[model samples]
Target: MYYVIRYGPAEDNSADLYMDPIPGKKVSFTRGERLGTLPLLTFRKRAGDRGAFLDYLGSSPPCMVVSDRFVEALRSVGVDNVDFYPAQLVDEATGKATPGYQAANVVGLIACVDAAKSVYTLMPGLPEGGAIPKNGIFEFKSMHLDYTKVHGAKIFRLFETTSTIIVHESVRDAIEKAGLRGIRLIPAEGLDAFY
Candidate 1:
């Protein structure tokens, strides 16, 4: 199984675990409609747009426990056994629960990630729609990254508690700083498949 970590919006307690739009304000993507509505640009990375990235995080956070994108990214590449966590959970840093529908601090999110069970898989070539295999162990060079700078720190911390399967030395080294173990480094290229 592939484990992924995702944060919830700091909104009120009544919002869906994924912080889905309040009915009418929902936006849909070409692949499909996510439970939560985010601008298309939110998924695509922009050069040196850290503030924009941060603003997106500030407003939407990431209700990943129920995110279709999170699951689909892995699933599309034949890594279908994916799961997400840290939903409506209390923040360890703060003595209070995450803001239900309001807003939350980044530190609280860090705490939630530290307490979740996320799966990180390192693969070389990502699978395409027609050429996916049913089941087997495959290896390739690391080419892409599953998490962005905004996502890596928050989620990679959980690698400390789980037995993750990594195939790239650089990727392993990157996450090692976050305190990860159970590593099984292999040969691979970019992880573009997860995108």
Candidate 2:
């Protein structure tokens, strides 16, 4: 079974942090593209707050920044579809840099969602009265994948929704076993309920 990974609930009175690519740094992690070189990024921590660092940090435009522990756990489970790039989480308030984090890019695209079984709405056409494009982009109400097309992929960004990250059951097990923080694995079949 596949799972949708999302950030866990925030701690009370703690800062909610989000990563952002530094100005002029090109980022393509969300599109499943390889970065020839590392990009400069920073985590903007909310002001006047106390929060512990988390194993997973989410970014704008929907990218992932994971702790080294997360990377190691996935590797231990033989997950190879993801590439990691070195990144530092610089505190916006103190300008302090925290290491042991990496920008995770789930490589490859898989158009594996079973549209007939999934609940979604098509995006409007670019021009008025123009033909609606049946591409990956859509407003998903509930997504069900064609597992046959997944081919045992442990982790990937769905071609039907590039911003969504899907992981295999084994991967979720490994993450849970490792006691990783800041992540929640939702069963793909139960996604509709959450929405």
Candidate 3:
């Protein structure tokens, strides 16, 4: 299965999607030539509460999953096992609508699932360590954040050795600024050019 993870803007009302009690800052990035600041999603945390992708991936990985000649190339190479993991926030433990989950972390977890598809995946918001059916191929969206470093590194390295990491052209600068390498950047419209 192929898991394609991309850092793009949120699809709908982020206020409803994210669980951050504190307000998030508007962060700037580019999609093609257009530049804008996307609302970076943060998790809402009370004093003693602590939970994240790390706690989940420590045992298993998050949502398993991605596309585009990206589409052609994938087809040419016979790489059809793809899925997109959505970017959302929820309590990993109860799988309820608690709060305190970063969009980027969510994406990373999705990538984690794609990397290791052997283990089954829980519901998108459910805690990391759980069992479910093994369905391969997924696609998903996510924002950029620092918290995804650990998961990103592991996943990126896996891509380096095993799979291919295809990043969108818009988020390339941001990814570079964040010091992420070994990615193939291509336009959203057509995946003809990759670097």
Best by TM-score: 2
Give me the candidate number with maximum lDDT: 2
Better by TM-score, candidate 3 or 1: 1
Per-residue accuracy of model 3 over 23-133 as CA lDDT, tens digit each: 554321111112123353333223333533221111112111111212233234333333222223445445554332222211122223332323232335545544322
lDDT of 2 by residue, 82-189 (tens): 888887776777878889988798998888877677776665543423332334345667777789998999998877567778899999999989999988888886
Over the full model, what C-alpha lDDT does candidate 3 score relative to the true structure? 0.28
Q: Residues 56-152, candidate 1, lDDT per residue (tens digit)? A: 1212433222233323333333432222222232323332343222222111111121111222333346543332232211322233233332233
TM-score of 2: 0.84
lDDT preference between candidates 2 and 3, better one: 2
Deviation (Å) of 48 in candidate 3: 5.6
Task: Show model 3 residue runs off by greater than 4 Å.
Answer: 1-59, 62-82, 92-195
Give me the overall lDDT of model 1.
0.26
Misplaced by over 4 Å in model 2 are: 11-25, 49-51, 126-137, 193-195
Give the worst 10-residue stretch by lDDT in candidate 2.
126-135
lDDT (0 to 1) per candidate: 0.26, 0.75, 0.28
TM-score, every prediction: 0.20, 0.84, 0.18
Model 2 lDDT on a 0 to 1 scale: 0.75
The C-alpha RMSD of each candidate to the native structure, in angstroms, is 17.0, 3.5, 17.4
